[model samples]
Every structure is written in C-alpha cells, then in structure tokens.
Target: MLKGRPLQYFGTCIALLNMLGMGWPSPFLPVLERDPLTSITKDEGSWIATTYLIAGPVGSIIAGIALNKIGRKRSLLLSALPFLTSWIIIAITQRLGFLLLARFIAGIGGGAIYSVLPIYISELVDPPIRGFLISVMGTLTIVASLFINILGYYVNITYSSLICTLPSVVFLLFFPFIPETPNYYIVNGKIDVARKVLSQVRGRQIDAEEIQELVESNEKGLAKAGVLDLFKIASNRKGLFVCLGTMGAQQLAGIVPIIFYTQTIFEKAAADFPVIASTSLLYVLLIVFSAVSSAIVDRLGRRPLLITSISCCCVALLMEGVNLYLKSQGGLNSIGLSWMTLGDLSFLVIGYSIGLLVLPSVFLSELFPLNVKGLAVGFCNIYFSVVAAAVSKLFQITSDHYGLHVPFFVFSASSFLSLVFAVIVVPETKNKSLEQIQIDLRNKDEHNKGEQTHLLKKYCSEQ
Candidate 1:
C-alpha cells in the first residue's frame, strides 16, 4: 500500500526462516530418537528441543553492541551467517551431539534476530501502520513454525532442514539492497543519506518542518545509555518492567514448551489419535488468529487485546488441566471425551496467537526511548531465553514425575497471575509515534509523584 511496504514485508522473510529453523525439532523429536544414525534417549531428545536457548543470551549481548556500531542491516546480515551454517549442519549430522550443537548455533542467530528486527521495523515504518507491520512479522514467524511442523511430518528431518536454509540464502542475496533506517543515518550525521532514505520510504520529499522534528528527536536520543541508565531513569525502569513481565508471563505459561513439544503433548495425551494432524491444525489456528490480531491491533489498542488474551489463556489452560487430570485417572475414555485434548489445545492456540504472541515484541519496540531501546530490548530478549529454557525443562520434568495435568495446572495458575499483571501494569501504546510514547512514559511518572505529594500535604494539614 505504501511506497516501500513491499520491501518492508520482504524484510520479515529472515524472521520467518529464523523460526523455521528454531522450531525444526518440535515434530521430529520422536523421529530423531528412533533414527539409528542419530538415536537419542528421551532426556536427550528434550535437550534437542531446548538447547537453542543456551547461546541466546550471548547472541543478544552481541546484538546490543552491534546495533549502534554496525547498524541494523549489517547486524541482520551477520546473524544470517550462523543461521545458514546451523541448518546445513542439521541436514547432514550423524551424531546427536552435532545435532545439539547445531541447535545452539541457531539459537545464537535467533537471539540476535529477535533483538534487532523489532527495533529495525519500528524505525522503518510510519506510525499509522507500525502495529500492523510488526504484527505481520510475528504472524510470519508463526507461519514458519507451522510450516516446519507439517514439513517434519511429511518430509525427512534432513531434507526439511536443508530446505529451511533457503531463507537465509535469499536474505543474504536480497536484503543488502534495502536502505538503512533514517534514524540511524540521522544519529550518525549522514543528513543527506537520511533524507534520501526517508523520502524513498515515504514516497515523498522531506519538508523543512518534518526534517527539523526528526533532527530534534535524534538529538534527544543521542545520549548514550549505560546499563545503570536502564534502572536509574524512572521511565526506562517502568518500560523494562512492563516488557519483562509480559515476556515472563508468556514463557511461564508454557507457550514455548507447547510449541516445541506439540507432537509429544498430543501423543502423551492421546496416543491413538493422529498427533501430527492435530498439531498442524493447532498451528493453523495460530496463523489465522495472529493475522486477525495484526488487522485489529491499532484499532482496539494494546491494553484491551492483552487483557482479553490472558483471560482466554487462563480459561483454556484450566480446561486443559481438567481434561488431562480426568484422562490420567482413567475416566476420560469411559466418558467419551478423548477429543478434549485437541479441543483444549486449539483453545490455547487461539488465545496465545491473538495477543500474547505478538504484543511482547510490540511493547519492546514502543516502550523505551531510543537511547535505551537497544540495550533494554536486548536484555529483555536475554531474559526471555532464560525463562523459556527454564519453563520448557520444567514442563518435561513435571510431566514425567507427576503428570501432564500438573504442568497444565501450574501454567493455568501462571496465566492468572499474568492476567493480573496485564490489567494492572501494561500501558496503551496504540496510534502513538515513537517520541510521543517516550513523553507519555515521563508524564505518567511525574503525575503519580504529584498525586503522592498532594496526598501527603493533605494528611499533614488534617492532622
């Protein structure tokens, strides 16, 4: 619709491929354990599903350092190197250790991509379509995950992995032609380049007033932020809290484990059913509902969407926990409710994809000022990997020791906590420019301080 919107859409291609490689192990875990050339134990198979997170923090740190030094386009190009190598390794690896090593390498690329891409896209697009564009990127990642699930079911793991490498190859070949962000050029004092790139993106020449506004915005953001600045500044501190809370809630609710172990969950819940088909259908719902969210996010706003999503997830998880509990106790079959596993999982997919899946990235891109955004979002992604790894392992341990219902119940409770957090803490960021968001964060903090002082003075006079 816009001048450079096609290229913006193409920019999301790497993200799609990133998730494709990241989610490769989800449906193939059981197959890998049974393959004679790369046989692994149940415990080792779990490692294959989660070891991508091991190197994620390191990659995020690298992305944080590179965002300013190398710029967004080059950082993305650097990330593609690891992605290409990892997928190639997976395609030919005969040893289980090699397979796990490949996954860790992919995690490195994934971490960098997650940290950099959101900030890049936010800076590139206009405010009117910013939410839609970002949400579309999230949707494409979901589509990639779904594609891997179906591909693993129909094709061999080696062949599927080799196919996954194509996205990286395409990105390397095409992405270099795209322009860097206007913000990055302005900050670096490349005014002519910034103007040319901005006009190209906007389909018009830059006017004097807009150019002055852009200069002033860049000037405000030019102050370099240290790690302490994240917590030392009140607005930055609040932004970090909001981001971590959303990411933590999503991870703790077992969304990562659910996506990574979809076939495993279905087999454990209902062995006789067609697990792959059910899993594929579940991901289809994710893609469909995530698209719906992309279409409506700017109109409905962030706060309401998050509230509705968490509420739906809480109910769905509770239902899933109850269904598993009944099935585990040997009563589910007698009552003719075996289909409830698929039902509950479909509910979870709808709930997660609509809001929880996409909003975390949106918050990361919108909340913090440019000065702290790269560092704050980098740390946020690092924290996301840690929680995801812990929760994924915890899901396996609890399900094996106690029952599948135990983890489901725990996740249900976690969703309730997340719901409370969303309602109480998350801010509305719809239809606001990046600079406007920074101003609002400061204004809200100052307003709260003024209210506290007035209440204190009132109490003193009354006493």
Candidate 2:
C-alpha cells in the first residue's frame, strides 16, 4: 500500500497536469489571435476554441476504446506527447494553418484526458476517497487556468505559450511512477497482478477475500453487461440523461464565454477597467474559490452544493443583466455604483466556480457504470463541445446586437432550469458504489412507476 501511495499521487498529479495543459491557453486566445503572425479575425479566432471542442467528443470516444486496450498508464503517457508537441508548434510556428492543426491535436489530448482520467481514478481508489480525488482534478485545472490567466495578463504571449509546456513536461516525468489500475488488470485476466495493484492503491495489504470479491464483482458486472449491451438498460437511460444534462449545464453556465472571452465580458461590464489585467485577476480569485469548493465537496455532498451553487449563479447572472440594463439606461452616475458592478461580476464568477464548473464532471463520473463509462462520458463531452461552440458563437452575436446582457440572461435562465432538473431528477451519489448506484437508480425508477400505478388504481376504484 505504501508503494501504491506514490502511484495514486502520481495519477492525481498527471490528471492535474492534463488540465493545466488543456485550460491555460484558453484565457489568452484573444492575444493569440491578435498576434501579427496569425492576425485572425474575431470570428476566426472563436473558431479556434470551437475546433478544440469539436475534437473533444471524437477524442473521448477513441480514448475509451484505447484505455481499455492499452491500459491507463500507457494511455496517459501517450496523451501527454501530443500536448507537448502542440505547445512547441504554437510557440514556433508563424503559419495560421499549422497553429490550428496544433490546437486541434491538443484538443484531442485534452478531451481524452478528461474522459479517461475519471475512469482511471475510479478504478484506482476505494469508494470512500474516490469522489474527493476525482474532484481534485477539476480543482487543480481551475488553479492552473487562474495561474496562466495571470501570466497572460502580465507577461508576453510568447512567454505564456512557452510556459504552458511546463505542465506537460511535469506529467511526462511522473508517468513512470503510476501503475495500471487493478480493474484494467482484471479485465485483461491477470488476477494475481490485479490483486497486487489493488493492495498498493488501497494503502493496505488487501486480504485475499477482498481481492476475490473485487474480481467477482467485476466479472459479475461484465456478465450482466456485454460490451454492446449498455444501450439496453433502463439505468443507462437515466445515466445518459444525467450525463447530457450535466454537460449541457456545464457549458451553458456561461463558463466558456468567461474563460475564452474574459476581456470582452469585462469590457462590457467595466469600460474603464484594464480588461486583460482585471479579467486575469478575477479568474485567479474565482479559481481560489473553486479549490475551496472542491475541498468541501465530499463533506457537503454533491446535491446540496450543486443546488446552492447553481442558485447562486442564477442570482449573479441576473445581477449582471441588471447592471447592464442600468448602464444602458444611463443609470451609472456614481463611482460607488461603478465599483459595485465589479463586485456583482465577481459574485457571478465565484458562484459559477463553486457550483456548475466543479460539480458536473464529478457527478458524471459517478453516474455511469464501468461497461459504458468511457462512451457515456464521451457522449457527454460531445454535447459539451457542441454547446461550447454554440455558446461562443452566440456570445459574439448577442454582444453585437442585443448587448452583453442578453447572453447573461440566457445563461441565467439555463442555470435556473438546470437547478430544477438537478433537484427533481439527479440522484445523490455521494460515497455510493457504482453497483449500488445502479441499483438505486433502478429502484427509484421502479418506485416512481409503482406510485403512479397505485394512484391510478385508487382513482379508478374511487370512481
């Protein structure tokens, strides 16, 4: 177990590094477009982000198949190489064509990392610590994003692009320290090796009974679910709905617009504020809040935090819309009120950081069974990427015609709807085993129908 601790930590670190590589360049894309070598139009620049997400769904599907065959350790190592090459290309290349290709390739790496890492983490840790560890990946990614945004705000673009390479290097260094997941070994029919790997990750010498149970549980799960059988289950239906809903919520939470077009949002909000610097500082502060939220996720549980945080987001978005409405009406006469606008925007950022951004990935990871984990996550990501693309384009259009406030209003409504869906439909998965979760969802579905049947019989008898 002691030997395995290093490997678990190594996996966690690799997940963090993946997020850093994926997220760091996003906030500074405007600067990238503005560079003389590229000199892209605003619409074309937005496509860069769109293209990255376009690859995400496809990459995630590939990663699911690849991880099962190649194993977690090798898949992670291979994913890092593309990220390294992408950074180098962006740093050296003057051609727009090459730069787009590099970004697309980087997106593939990012998408795969996002899809596969959760499954890897799930396979590595015990049920108790799984949520906390998986949630940390997102927390760390936000932190890296915050750090890079600050750098881009203050440093030159060339330096910022170069600095993005460091995390990939860090990942490559740590790759050899982690072991393949026990589940992966079990699937490959290496029972003894699987047990050894399990003992290491659990940080205690697992008993032969426990190892036997794990093997049996995995085999039973596989027996119940053939490779192509995930599509047939009622539980899978709920899982798909939850995955798609959460992914849609995540993108429509107005996060991508904030991350990719921070300067633009700030420009609309605070005309006199230094757009780049202020937006960077805001991202840093919000990221700090996201880290704090991650630490509390397990303690508070998923549902309550999701509800509260998303509700807070709705309020913040409304506040921003109101601020914009007031400004449009020539109502910002006081300096005090002007400063309050920044405060309002910060509230929106913090609310989103705490709720929508951090929880969706954690929830989706817990929602799916192993049989379809990869493909389910990949489909969710496809929706995420598609919405991200749509939102980016929508932001540009709304800002051009209706004003910045229109986008905020749209997001505010979407978040409110998400909160409703979460409360009514999403189950609490905190600390539950995957098998247990599947059973609960099935039972819940059964219970609902039983209640309906009872109500119908009672009404008919009464009539």
Candidate 3:
C-alpha cells in the first residue's frame, strides 16, 4: 500500500458509492415490471433501464468543466447531489415518468463521478500502485453494484433505493476531510497548496526537484491545451483514438444485456436457483475476479489481461449466440434447463468482470495528459453513454425482431474487433509516468511519420 492509503481509499469509496447507487435498479427491474406493486409495461421497464445512459453524458460534460474550474474534490462532492436527490425522487414518486426522471438525474451524477474518479485516484496515488489503485476503483464499483443488486433483490424498491442513497450521503460528508488532487492544485496555480498536498498524500516532503518537475509538466500541458487541442495535438489525437477504442469496447461489450437479462435467461432455461441467487453468485465472482485483477495488473500489464479476458468474452458470447439460435429453432433439448447456456454466461461474466470492466477507466486515467485528462474522460463518457444507450435499446429490439442470437452475435463480433484494436493501439503503461507515456506516444507517431515520408519519396523518385 502507498503512504496515506487509508485516506486515498476513502476517496475511492466515493467512486464505488456512486456506482453502487447506479446498480440499484438493475436486479429489481423484474419486480417493478411484474410484481403488481409497480406493474410497469415491458416498454416502460426498458426505458427505466436506459434513461441513466441518456443523461450520463450530460453529467460528464458538466463534471469535466467543473473539474477544471472548481477543483476535483468539490466537483465530485457536487456530483453526489444528483444521485442522492435522485433516490429521494425514487422513494417519493409513483409516476413512471418521474421514475425515468430520477434515473436520469442519477445517471447525470454517475457520469460526473465516473468521469472524475479515475482522474482523482490517479493523482492521489504514486506510480508504484497507481494502476493497482485505479483497478481497485473498478473492483469497488463491481462490489458496490453487486451490493445494490443484492439489496434490491430482497428489499422493496423504495426502501432499496433509499438504502442506496446512504453511501453518497456518507461520501459527501467524508470527502471534505481529504484534500484536493495535487495535480489539480498545480494546474490551478496553487503551488504551495500543491506542495502540501503532495507531502500529505505521500507522507513525506516532496523535494524541490520533484515539485519543479510537476510544475514544468503542468506548464507544458497548459501551453498545449485549447478548444481543438484534443484533436489537434498529435499525442492527444492518438490518446483519443486509443481511449475511444478501450472505453467504447468496455461500454458496448454486451455487459448490459448480460446482467440486465440474467433473470430472463435463467427463467427461459428453467435454472434451478432463483435469478436473484444466480445473479448474486456471478456478481460475487465479478468482485473476486476484479480483486485479483487489481492485485495482478501492475505485474501482468494491461494489454495481456485485456486481450485474454476479451478473448474469453468473444468466445463465450459466440457460444451464447449459437445456443440461443439453436434453442429458438428447436434444435436444442432441455431437461428443466440448459447447463451449457448458464455455463457460457459464467465464462462471459468472469471475463468481463476481470479485464474489460476494470481496465478502460484505468486506461482513461493514465493515457491522457493531465491538461486533457478531464476533457478526455468527459468525451469518452459522452461517447460511451450514447453507445450504452444504443446497445441497451438495441438488445431488446434485436431480440424481438431478429432473435436473441442477433444481439449476442453482434456483441461477439464487437468484442473480437475490440480485442484486435487493443492489441495494436493500446500501450503498456506498467509503472510509467504520464509524461513518459506522452513521450512514447510522440516518438511512435514520429516513427510512423518517418516511414511515410520515405515511402512517399521512393514513389516520387520512381515516377
């Protein structure tokens, strides 16, 4: 563990709490749909699940701007307001529209927290365990999400939602004790405060040399930043492409359908255990796998774990597609249930839990330059929110018109393609600094440019 880890972990819990609040509605959607208590239609039920995504991008954009203007801790503290207020809305509202509105509001907060958390954690921890702690953020979200899923599984909707809000309330209160990110302070011209923060977080005095290095990096970052800088700067442009691929793949990896349709799949297969129990089991594994991932990511490197996990995901989704296709055509036989179907899902859940779930946000935190970190995170969230919304809605439409196999096949194909993109585009950060990553990206681009120039000259001379 790094120095001042307990305080750092407290800050990271805010990220977990935010995501836990987001997960409350997933497992209980069944109750809201058919329990006769809420009694929402199929269509209305689907909308309730997706409205979070639609509003997420909006929250992320606001968080990005606020991250720069107000500072990370306060921006994060403010982000909790929407999620807490949202649970209150859920407890009070019986109207379907109001329910959707509440989810949307919470999604907004999630967007901000999701966008800002990686940045906050990255700055809080040193390089040795930076990836590990960032991965911890990922595991914590799974833990939080699964806890809410289990809570919502047993409890009534209003009480479950009210229970979920408590984390955010606790976060809002406890976070003031933690200081702002030194990177944020440095960037905002709070040099003395940045020094103190760095000392406090590291539990040792930051030497003049290290402080100077940080200040110089921020100066360079500020000089290069602008409205179109994300696209205009060569290093940032490459970072953007890589971030998009990783973030998009994570968001669109059919995870929503995997978790969202867990009960549906179990019901169709006539699984022995209740959907709640099976879902709980897989989610428990998700936490376990994520913890293992956090423990090992610093040593194993990001690319291998991602490639391996996603490869497993690709195969599992394909197997799932085949099984669904065969079952729909009556080519499959069942004795109360199909073990193969559940087995395929277990593989998929384990794969996603370990790599795809944890790494993309870590990549987002590490890959971008500090000046563009917030903007890059914001952009990825907005993009991911749109993709998430599409996949959520598409899962139903494709399942209805095209059959469940269609969406499964589509997801399988996306996973395979994303795996290839990751192999080629994503770099191994390992224990490298953000400045080091920028330099490496710049050099790689220059190498490519040199080859292109040579090829052009050779062709021109031949002509």
Candidate 4:
C-alpha cells in the first residue's frame, strides 16, 4: 500500500524500533527481577526503566546540533548505531551493569530519533495527509509494545534483545534510499536541489508557486538559528510554548509509567486475570484507536480530538483511582467489582491512544518555523525526557508508600489540568502547509500584541 510513497513507511520504521527499545522494560523487568541469575532488586529494576530516560537529554542535544551540520538523514542514520550496539550488548550480557549501560545507550538513540524523525516526516508529506502520516508513528509504537510483550512472554531476555535488533539493522540498510527533506536543502542554500527533492517526493515536477513559496519562507526566517533565537521572535516563542505545553500534558498524564509498568499494574489490580493476555488486549485497543485518530485527525482537527481524548483520560483515570482505592480497602471483592480495574484501564488506554499518545509530537513538528524547528524540537524532547523520568519515579515512589490509588489520583489531576490547557491554548494546525503555519503563527502573535498595546494605551489615557 505504501509503495507509492515508501518514504512515509521507511521514515517511520525507526520510530517503531525506538518505541520498542523504550518499552523493553514493561515485559522484561519482572522476568529479570525473578531470575536468580540476574539478582535485580526492586530498586535496581526501577532504574532499568529510568536509566533509559536519564540518557535522553544527551541524545536530544546531540541531534539538535547534528541536524544542521550533518543533515537530518545522516543524523538519523547515526542514531541506529547506538541501538545496534545496545541490543548486541543486551543479547550477550548477564551482568546488571551491562544491562543498564545497554539501556542507557538505547535511550540515547531513541531520544535522537524522536527529536528528529517527526520533523522529517512533517516536512516530507503533503499537508492534507500530514496528520495521518505523522500519527502512524503512534500506531507503530503500540504495535511495538504489543510485539515486545508477546515476544518477551515467549522468550528469554537475551533472545528478545537479539530479536529487537533486527528493526535497527533494517533501518540502517534501507533508510538511505530516501532523500533529504526539501526544507533541509532550502535552508541550506540549495534551492535547485530542494526543487528536485520536492519533485521527487511528490512524484511530479514542482510547480513554480510552490518553489517560490519555499524561497520566500527561506528568505524570511529559514536561515541558521540558535537556541536563543527560539525566544527572540514572537512566533517562535509561541510555537515553543505550545510544543512544551503539549509535551507536558502528554507525559504528566502518566502514560510513561503505565506503559513501563503495564504488567505490574495489571498484576496489582487483578491477580487472577491473566496478565499477558490482558496487557496484550490493552495494546490491541490502543492500536485500534490510534488508527482511528490517525484516520480522522485531519477532518476533525486537533483541538476537538485532544479535548475529547484528554477528557476521557481524566474520567477513566478517576474511575481507576476509585477502583484501586476500593480494592485496597478490601471492599471490591465482596462487591464483585474486581473486574472494574481492567475495565477502567481499558477506558484509559482508549482515551490515551486516541489523542494524548499521538498529538503532542505532531504539534511539535508542525508549530515551529523551519529556522528554529530542530532546536525547538530538541528542547521540547529534553523537557519530555525530564518529565517522563520524574513521572516514572513519582509513580513508583508514591505507589509504594501511598498505594497505587494515590498515583492514579495524581495522574487524573494532571489529566484534568492538561484538558484545560488543550481547550484554552493548543492551536489547530490541521490541513495547513508548513509555510502557511509559520505565517499564521506570526499573524496571530502580532494580533495578540496589538490588543495588549491597545489596552495599555487606553489604561494610560484613563490614568
């Protein structure tokens, strides 16, 4: 089906692998802790998840720097090396230290790929189908989780790690065939090359107007930009704020912890239910709704989907908290309500997969101008890394001391706050060209500034 546009499929393959690597702990941690050979304590097992995130900021910074100097394609290609190395180490290592080192190395590659891949996809696809193409990454991520869960259940850690390395190897061998994005060429003073790339990707000769728009946008602000430049312009500032807020909402809502510890959560709530079966079913629901979100994102627009998605998360998480609280108090079994935990979690996955899981990265890739997109994405990804790590640790600590209900309540509160933020602040970038989005951001910023100035003048006159 993607033969007509192999770029879309190939470009996102590495993301599937990235998510698989990031989610490796979900199924493997419990197995590792139980194994006599590993001797992993609970605290040490927690770091198995956290260490991957701890190394993310370094990778984000490296990608941000390399994106301009080496081009997006080269930077992405470079990311595969760490993944390849990490999995190899995982396949052979029996020591806990090597496992952590391997996970940290994998995290570096994952961070770099996350920071750069979405931007690359956004630039390559047409605006009409951009949301669908980009949101496919979400679906692939769910697929990765599901795949790893099944694989880990059937195989030992060594075999699982060795199997995971195949995606990275495939990426290394195939991704080079795809051309660099026209935006990269345009910004780098290669207009003729940009035109050819644009033509090739679109499967036709590039029109003059499209080429002219690229030139004009490049002339306006697609020059080389540093991190500080992200704040100096009103549009860039707004874009950065939006991207950061989106990321904050996504991470703070507890997706990372839930993903990292899905089996643990299931085991805690419904010990009788088959953990692997339930987790696999949960991932299946996620894959289904993620595909639904991708199909309708362009038609429905981002704001509505996000508003609905976050609202569902809030309600589902609140229900889950109540269910866990009742279970902790020994009230659920007598009332025959043990099934509520699975049902409530299913609801939460439905909510998260539909919007919260998919849209933040889409916003990151869409909101910024070409000049500062790479740097802005890097910064947002670093913020993502920090929040994800903190949330993961917070979930573990709070659950240990205060019961799982406490962390669920906290996550529910964060989801409510994020819903408010989405309704009030997040802008719709659906069906808009990249250059047009930049212009709209500028115009919207100027309009707000004008209103503020007018109010200030009126206040002075009254005084």
What residue runs in model 1 are displaced by over 4 Å at the alpha carbon?
A: 1-21
CA lDDT, every model vs. true structure: 0.82, 0.74, 0.82, 0.82
Model 3 residue 113 distance off true place after TM-score fit, in angstroms = 0.5
Tens-place lDDT digits, model 4, residues 1-463: 1322665555555444544544573667777778899888888988888888988998999998888778888888888888889888988985799989998998899789888888888888788888887888788878877887788888887898888888877777777777888888887888889898888777778887989877987676566677898899888888888888878888877977876777677667765767777777788999999999999999999999999999998998899888889888987872344468778888988999889888988898898877787788889889999999999999999999999899889989988999888988889998998878888988998899999999999999999
Indicate whether candidate 2 or candidate 4 has the larger TM-score. Answer: 4
Judged by whole-model lDDT over C-alpha atoms, candidate 1 comes out at 0.82
Give lDDT tens digits, candidate 2, residues 215-308: 6755545443444554677777888887787767777778677567666665655546666556666777676777777778777788887788
Q: Which stretches of candidate 3 lie over 4 Å from their true place?
A: 1-6, 35-38, 458-463
Clashes (candidate 1): 0
lDDT of 4 at 135: 83
Per-residue lDDT for 121 in model 2? Answer: 80
lDDT of 3: 0.82
Question: What would the per-residue lDDT of candidate 1 be over residues 1-463, giving only the tens digit for each residue?
Answer: 3357665565555444444445564657777778887778989987876788877887899998898888987988888888888888888874888888888888899899888888888888888778887877678777878877778778887899888887788777777777788888776778888888888787788976887788886565778779999999999999999999999887776777876776666766654667667767887898999999999999999889988988888898899888888887886772244477778788888988889889999889888776777899789999999988899899999989999889889999999999999999999999999899988988999999999999999999999
TM-score of 1: 0.95
Number of the predicted model whose lDDT against the real structure is largest: 4
Query: What's each prediction's clash count?
Result: 0, 0, 0, 0
Could you estimate the TM-score for every candidate?
A: 0.95, 0.91, 0.95, 0.95
